[model samples]
Target: MRHNKWWLLVLALVLGLVLTACSGASDSTEDDNAGENESAEEKVLRISSPSDIPTMDPILAEDNVSIQYTDTVYEGLYRLAPEGEIVSGIAKKDETEVSEDGLTYTFHLREDAKWENGDPVTAQDFVYGWQRAINPDNKSFYANYLMSGKIKNAAEIYAGDLEPSELGVSAPDDYTFVVELEKPVPYFESYAAFPTFLPMNKEFIEEQGDDFALKPENMLSNGPFKMTEWNAEAGWKLEKNETYWDAENVALDGINVKVIKEPDTALSNYEVGELDRVTLYGSQVNDNQTSPEYNSLAETSVFWMKFNQESKTASKYMQNENFRKALAKAFNKQAYIDVVYGNDSTPVNYFVPKGFVKHPETEEDFQQGSDVLAYDVEAAQELWATAKQELGFEEVTLTFLSGDSDVAKSISEFMKGELESNLEGLTIEPNNVPWSQQLEIMRNKEYELAVSGWGPDYKDAISFVDLWVTGGENNDIAYSNKEYDALVNAAKGELATKPVERFEAMQEAEKIALEDAAIAPIMQRKTSVLAKDYVKGMDSLNPFGNDYSFKYVDIVK
Candidate 1:
């Protein structure tokens, strides 16, 4: 952490607003600005989050908090545009070429792009970063989860059957980089815009060894802003990178963020000019819509409780799909939203959030055009009875792992009451844990059931749908089905180039999972924000969970 006046609050508001998010990059369709323009100077754009950044290493980032800090410093081949389009970042759009078959992508690194340390950013930098991410020895959570089969030999490398050098990405020269994918992936360019695809400074990384990315001195930035100070508990600061390739277009002079956990305190700070933006959660949302600063945006994220088929305790009945269906149908989705979220979101019966994807030919919403798994209480009871009869257990206590936050606990308690009352002889014992702890618990697959969500990393439905593939990295439920894997594989392989087939395959994959009760779809999320009038150009629709870009942000009086 750098010793300077810093704004670590970015994490506080960032986590509060974006980290809690479960889905990814959103299309910009809701902005009401008539080009009033949001800009800042001399000082930074002030935002608050409830937590500190967990890590700055892109390969190591699992949560949005870590991605926020690292993403600010790292420039990838592509960057996400305001409307959720793919724009060139380190690699210029004109210089990039895709093979006729879409199996290969070639990127030409811009000569003007340089690291914050004045070293020229090169093609090999990307090669090294890709290798490091896919290297099983580095233990990157996103490596196999995000890229595994997408990149040639990536799965083999993670499984120790092949070396990192075998991965299909390479740089023939400092200015030219080429990537070979296993198949045609229309969303691959959008994926390249993600942090996991960012380049690394090889020399600096090897010099710092394990200490790389831990401090300002050890980190390097090629993005529009560079970190000048980072205090884990105190705060962090980011200054505009003067040498950035597109620095002239950047608006902010610097960004100072602080950490504030309480909604009232954060609101108080925002009122006093101590913070520029704050997200109001739970009950804090009511009675604030009349404020000039109040703004709300529909989020692509969704919340669901994953049923663990491999229970550590004696709740083996979870392995039964009938039991899973019973639990899914027993919940009141609308009531869940009204109670847990103060009705800020909509009840969703499917895994993929609505408006996330569109039909190739008709342009209709992909989710709206598909078949849905119906939710009903009467059908739930029959499924529960049949499940119990098969398992020889009249009653079962399902252990649920959830967040320790006030709203999280309340939601869990609310669901427990609803499930127990609706389905007789059922017990839900929720073990509330901190957000970080809860993630680890689920990652380790140490819980019987857990509430978790995925924000898409890209615009495609596959971004969230791929998470449920058999043995995929985020599938902590220990749920697996050959049919599910087949449908998903078809979507990513044979159906990729054919947009209609691809959409249909994904629709089928989602159908198979939902029908089997792989996870309970509660509701799609929408965040009510007390956005400062001066805060402009911050992105809120990116489905990738990067809620905003600070480069063009401003704070005008």
Candidate 2:
């Protein structure tokens, strides 16, 4: 009896042990599958910007930051898709009609489209916005720019030769908007997607007057995101607009941006999982090239040193063509890029960036077979000698203007060193200022030499070549060439319908500008960025327009 009792106890203990082991295995399996059964978390993306957006008004917004922010908060007739395709915004794409000559476009706006204030978006808003842009009294910088040569009577309106009411855009009814073009523009859809072409409510704008777009409450959004918070010193926050027409398809809940000027600080935040995206430069790029998060993206932006040929500037030497050529060739572009950017950015001698646009018929890259302004040290010295003799001065000093950002400072310092070393008795004073101040100085032509850059507003060589045209709005350098202007104008006017000839004309225009040394070409920018692995659906880095479209971006784990 005692032996049987002991055997029973032993059997009980073994069963207990087996049950404990089985329970442990079950808990492990549940732990492994826990995430699958849990509810999804809210999708919010965090990003960093180097500086605050310059302005909120699309008509006056010239910088990329302002354009990017404005594009998200406002809707044009057309919008660029995530993959850079022209997509419908307020206007229904399939219902739109075009004249056989491609000179007129009639758009039917969607009835359901409403502004953030719950007012129905109408075709008259577009007419009013376009007319305001062309109104000479408004002094919009981009008025006669992209619109003048294309939109019928736009140039005349901007020049005060005609009334703004006669500017070619009309609203027949509440929903029908008609535009008359001066000529056939192949890239008209691309232009329509730009921020400058966005609609504005005349009543709302007039009510706000000078206070318009200065604060978040003063604005209304008609796009996928709405600005919920804006603090220039801190940054801005954008939340998904529940009132947006296509809000159901918009994936991101919100995007939080911070203005972090220091790359080190930005990277540290990224490492701690505080930031999902950040741009890196110089040594930061070199250190993280092997990381999975690293990405080197080629962009359409090209930076150059713009010489102020105005006689009032301190550097009187810039008026001489040989002096400009000498300054253009004095530096080693490759070395400067390597020392400052430390990425895949290539040294370029031409203003138009490579791989940006292609020939219409041959489909060859636009920069192909184009003349290269070769860097010849010997030639540069000879040009400097001639310039000095012509100016009757053995020594010259110039102020070099640039932004105060770390990357900008590095670039300016390198150029200053190179110029001082290469050219005898040449002194380059590096003057680093805030971005806004730099822009103001450039606009007033208040600097001797300034580092400036241009990114495409549309995917065409004309975007780059048109800047140096005689009396062009963007021609802040005071550089003008009649031949260059003729070529560029032909590309925009008479050759508008001829794709190949237009392309060639722009190419020839760029060559003329470079030969005259209107601006010293530097390296085309290739941005180095780091993004978290869980961040998804941001597939396209646009060569034109806004860099990112957050509508399709999703966070998945």
Candidate 3:
């Protein structure tokens, strides 16, 4: 069997080489005729964004679009390579010094790393960025992330007990940045690579004032690419930053991303060569499966249904444990994915997606033997009966908030059908709104139920599990459990030094949340893309943070 699989791989590689050669040969005539134009052969990657970028400020970025764009234009101490590997950004490679006790990390910034305006990328940029992100006045959505990393005084500063200047980050010199952690974090480097930790030029930021990062001209770039043009109604464009320290190795000359919401429109543009890559869903996937351009990836992002415990219209129903459990069990996730996605995405029963992390000691997958999200229509009906009796109600109606995108609408419609069909006397009215509006509604706890998802900011399970903690920044559901909080706190506290114990605590915490139906696990997403044959060097998909790094991407001629 092993020999056969190896032979298959060899055959695939040979076929790939043949296809590449054929593509290059077919484009030779056009390339020769366009020699005088010059721009025809420029290496540009054209892609599509499902929504508009919410913000360019790294500190305020919470949605995927904002975070991905911020990642491209900003650099921190480190950056993530393809497949989530840590790589140098402004920090010099192999030059970071660590204390023997693991409480401090000192990074030496590369002098050559400079912003687009020719300002040197210094350690103080990082110091200012970290301090600004956690400052109370900023109201950064990711402020809690710093506390989770155990950065010294982060909790105190966030709690108003200490000042942001005392947040344990300092620049002893122009090129040396020091960080003090309250406890050792094994994933500190990974956190540094996150968008929220990206550096900001204090001078440029202050000069821009209220307009900072709100437009293309207001931003500075030390990363491989710098934004040249941006329009909220249109799209954004990024060009290679010549001032980047490693600009010589950067492949693409520019990247153009269009704000396209519908897959059919994106597919039409891709077919006409206006776009290089487009994602497919539902019947589109099956139609393109035989095409050479077809590609798919099982992502780390997980989608779920969140019930607002403080909802004005449905608080009584949402507060009932039986009601929430009944709704969670009433839907058939596998059937919905099959009908709506028509891809390789799998239904999930846990918050932490499978294949993301494993048991530190046994090396076993973390999702083993969990069925809290099981679908059982009969059991769901029974629970609904009990809930109705407890609440003294016969019929209930709730608003289901969702994004206005075609895909989001499909998911909402299917879920509404499933829940209404299984649970008697229940009506789900889906209120589809724009992506930004949906986020605002959920954040303000104005929705009875919402369809939401999360991709890890780092590699740890804590990234997903910590969202349900009481008063957590992302805890829009208003679900709280003291025991669950203790488990999560322990995992981040006393268990910080014990790998196995920490993993166990996180696992227990997830189980408790699922059992309580704090959120209904829907599916582990699989991104399926169709790319032109000439595109190369993007095979390895990032399981976290931004999905793609165009730094190494190229147009193979």
Candidate 4:
């Protein structure tokens, strides 16, 4: 899935605008005194983010909220550039040499890069990071995907039968790193850019213990910016690291990120010239789109309904295939897109959002097929009837759990009304919970039906299709298909050697999953950013979300 955190990204952009506005307004009062030092240049840039930095430890941080913050503070061997191309970061430039069987990889690292604390960044850092992640005791969900079968003995290591050192990653010296894989991976370089694979400073992690990521002092940054201040409730700030090897190329002096979840409050701050950028939603889009300040940008992300077939609390009704299909059929996607998103979004038919992947061979555009469980009252009623008869029930009630966002609430209400009115002998209950609680429920498979969205980890079709692959950690829906799983596994095995073949296999896997109605995909989300005309260099190479490079951003005098 793409690392597109729409809400969180919007919050960050809005907060950037807010901080700029606040400083601008305050600057007027100190203009006389500040004018003299104006020639000194800006040393900090302020940004806003909606979610808190969950963890500073890359191995433990999996969500986009944490990934976005970490991306600025940590440097990977390779980093994605603004043009969505991979560039050398810590490695300088790695040489890939495939083994005879095409299952082994050896990477040569740069010898000069050093950690923020002045310790040399050796290939051992990468080896240690990989070991820590796959260690069974750590139980990192991301580690399962990142290491998994890629490294020899990794699966066994994760199962606790083998020592962490037994994993396939090894640093022969200070600069040579070798990786052994159980199968060939085509997107391995892209995978290296992911947060889970970023190197960590062992000494710092050990010293800080559990509080390593709690404050700026406890952490050591390896990326363009270093953590300066992190007020749990207020926000976090990043100051440009002058010691960064690529510091000369970095534009912003610093960036401050605020956590603001409420759209109206964010918009109010933006309108009052307290924010440099803000994101508008549904009706707010209409209110702001016509405004002189509005600047909307679309991104590739999909928000949809996830059915927990393995739910312990509400499993009986949700596990029923007919019930799941009925719920999907009851939703009018176009109506939701029209009424909920308007011109700001487009309805999604497939689970993988459009613009996520390109054909490996032809490089042709792959559009989402019309295999959606489209809204049809009559069809929904028919499916519901069949489900009622099969279950030998007079009535069935199921709850839809979602985060407590205004948009989530509205969509839940819309779904409830649609299902209740269209399907007989069915009750649709809506449960609104905090995002943290909602994530817990989804992870534990505690909800019957839940509202959720996934952004790609890398720009690949496998990222999305892998969700339903049997026991995938991200498979909150408890969807399991042996054939689908086999196809995905096969694709993963052949990804490097047979790129076109792998894509075809994945396409077949997606078709099978969708035909089963494993999950209902709703709309493709567009990230709308309302920025003041003067903010420039907002674009960064980070594929995860909006990149805050305030170095090049300047307030027009």
Candidate 5:
């Protein structure tokens, strides 16, 4: 999980080539560096990270960093709470009404909800944002993937066959919004909490044009915090939005995120109290396990090896189901986790992570027996031998894509050694790039085999399962299975009302995806961070929206 923000997924970006372009005054009333006399309540939550902030605009956000910032700045009809629950944000929970038919929704916007600019956030903001996302001209990668077929006319609009104006959402007045759904989406509330569903000021966006949310000066927030600082390499900061409706509950005066690319440097700062939290890696993790400062967090992200069927180097080999299975069974998950997570993570055989969701009917884990185990070296060898003969390839060289971080590099080498040593005539070439470049290359379908990861877009399993469907937004690997698509579609459509049937459908899709070895599951990620004891209100994992919500976060110093 890039919580990398759990997007192995954001899957990482910056708005401008340089971050210094957006310098301006912060929303904070007092200077953070004033003096030692600064009260604990004035203490900014300083954290460190290895990468740069991508985009602040949710429409273009695909990586974890972008989503994280947007989550801090935007408010939707609902906001994601600690336990992945959808709580009211811009919309009033008690007043919002869903019709018995489940096709119509009436939202009563909170009159107090205001953007950072002091303008009242109205129902029109949501309509504009949703329309922009659905507009084919915007060319959103997540619009149809996340909202299509759910909202009336949304699917057609995304297909470029219908006008965006015809989309089902409408605002009769400034405070009242109505939504018409083509079908009843079971997790629609959770969907409402996603960044794509976030509201944006129509006047602000139209006036700013393309630069609407590209920089600090151009951006406006309606959430717990506002982007007070954003100098990508220099780091960024979030000051409590004084205009936010729920600012009273947002405890931290400011959040200072330092871009410390070096793990050691970040740890050093944390030790000296310059930073409240810093991520730990390598041997540092092993030493800090029992420390109260070490915050161990699990995630709903599965970092996997996605085989590109459209790739040139080894597409022929990848097309063979046996070959894909051979590659999947060749690696040792236990060994991989030890090297990567340092025994802090669990090996995953299925796409959905543990703790993601429970079986609706039995209350059993959805992943209890979904994995197809073939860890035996002998079995992998047998399968590989057959695949090699059938493909008639004496030797094959396939490229591996990964992020350039230390852990990513280490895991890349480990997988290279494991697969090359286990399978005859298999040569694994490692291509390590900046996270953003990795996404670009994968999207371009340039590699034969890619190291990919997916964090759920919502609480539902379809967030991950739909990635393997034909033409899915995140299906950069070009893997396709019609039956898997059918199951996912059925779960979202015909079986949506039947909880047990929907759950069964999702489970079946997962099984098919795994058994087919569409993507080789590596490990479910859990981040290791050195969080000060003062840092509170953040959950280890969130099944909905961003990995972490800063809305109620505080430094109890």
Candidate 6:
């Protein structure tokens, strides 16, 4: 009996041990499965922009497409949020400082921020970037605008007078950087958020040389994502940078960006679930305006007629103030907006787009077409007669250069008909070229009159007013006014510390620009994006163009 009892006790003890081990194993297996599921659920997002990316190199990139591409691969000291507010990026909140004169800026980099290649991101990286941009060999169109005469010898260097090393940027240590400006720019902080102002790895860039930005492996990034694939004209892909300082905040595993110029094709792809988002144009909006899947966003962009005041061949007539004014008065803005925008656009008569800036003194708003330059046939005829009489020409033939897109063609035809019908002696010609060529022609000042648009660089009145500031590279019109120049300069200098005073001065400058007929403001742009219902957190304010923040976006199931 004692032996049987002992066996039973032993059996019971062994059974209890087995049960305990099984329970522990089961819990371990469950935890492992949960982790695997979370990893499997990680998503890869796909996005699209209308234009092809020009280049990945920040120094060489100047156009909108290039700017968008750079946004994915690089980050500045600060970043502009969807709300147009400045947010810290590479630097911690405690590291930035503004000078008393507001002419100098200092930045201290966080210790954790590092390049993809395991190199620490230092202040010297920024100094190198600034020097490279202003370097005469680079010949970057955006360098002058960003430097804004700030880098000590940047202007002279651009003019071939000094070496790039003489520029104002300096780095005393790996973490400390200083930037000196030519004048006190109120929006300097916002400008710092631009991709052109981002830092680059000097060692890597120098090693790669001309072939640096050609491939994904050839470049190093400090942003949330790194370039994983680049196929030139086809498309590109971005994978989350595990080494990114704020990688925890970046939720998406990867992103694919496609360049689809044809709006219809893009829409088709979106409908088929291949594309996550697309931008709609003109009549297309009419079809989608009532749909639950469609969303229309109004961006701060002014589409206007750019006149070539510097063109020796075309400027003969375009240089005349009366000729330009006559053209502005002749065009029926209402009809143009109706035809171009259908029901989703607004007509603009002022250079400053609506919802862009408000009057600081009276709390009044400055908007497009708010102060009208009436569309009067009699007024247009009088101006045309004066221009014809002054120039002593019997017939004036002008070619308006435009993009080859369908919308662009329609706009050109509208202008040609308006000018020919309104003025007897005027013969308007249409020269439709590819969008890329159109930019070249405009930059070289080779067109008589052209259709163009100006998207804001920063959220300030100066962004618009500075375009015509005497020697501004963006001043394709060559419209020079000492009064306009003075107002712009005064605003930059006197109102650097006073936001309200600066706003008033800029408003006065914009008013003067419109009254002088610098450029004929056509209509404010309302961009339409058709996004999938699952895609969320893709939105932008007036100034910052369409930018995707993977950290905030999620794909709902």
Error of 3 at 156 (Å): 2.3
- Judged by lDDT, which candidate is best? 3
**lDDT against true structure, model 1:** 0.70
Tens digits of per-residue lDDT, candidate 4, 1-557, equal: 23322211112221111000000000001111222442446733433444454566766655555665676788778776663567787875547566888677777777667778878788888998888888878767667755687778988998889999998888889888788888877767766676677787788888888787778999888788898877774676677787787788776666656665566766766666556666565677776677776654454555667788887766776678887788888878777765554546676767665665778778765554765476677887788888888878887788888656565577678788877878877688999775555656766788887766655566666666776778776676878889999898888775557888888888888888777789877776555556777666553223333233233344543
Clash pairs (backbone) in predicted model 6? 152-168, 349-369
- Model 4 bad stretches (over 4 Å): 1-40, 94-101, 338-343, 494-496, 539-557
For candidate 5, give the lDDT.
0.72
Give model 2's TM-score versus the native structure: 0.90
Cα deviation of 414, candidate 3, in Å: 1.1
Candidate 5 Cα misplacement greater than 4 A, ranges: 1-41, 370-373
Model 4 scores a TM of 0.88
In model 2, the clashing pairs are none
lDDT of each: 0.70, 0.73, 0.75, 0.65, 0.72, 0.66
lDDT score for residue 337 of model 1? 66
Alpha carbon deviation, residue 282, candidate 4 (Å): 1.7
On TM-score, the stronger of 1 and 4 is 1
- Please list the Cα RMSD from the true structure of every candidate, rounded to 1 decimal place: 6.0, 16.8, 8.0, 5.4, 4.7, 17.2
On residues 1-557, what C-alpha lDDT tens digit does candidate 6 reach at each position? 00000000000010010000000000001111222344447666665544445468876555555555565578878775665567887765466888887767888888798889888888899988888888878867667655656556778988889888888889988888888877777767766776667898888998998898889888898888898877754677777888888888877777777655455766776676666676666577788888887776665555677777887776777778888788888888878766655556577777655776677666677653444355777898999899989989878788888766556677788898987999987887899875556656776788888766655666566667777889775676788989989888887776667878777777788878777777887765565667768776665432542233345666775
Candidate 3 or 1, higher TM-score: 3
Q: Where is model 4 poorest over a 10-residue stretch in terms of lDDT? A: 19-28
Candidate 5, residue 74: how far the Cα is off, in Å: 1.1
Q: Which residue segments of model 6 deviate by more than 4 Å?
A: 1-42, 360-362, 367-372, 545-551
Candidate 2 wrong stretches, greater than 4 Å: 1-40, 369-372
What TM-score, to 2 decimals, does candidate 1 have? Answer: 0.89
**How big is the positional error of residue 464 in model 4, measured in Å on the Cα after superposition?**
0.9
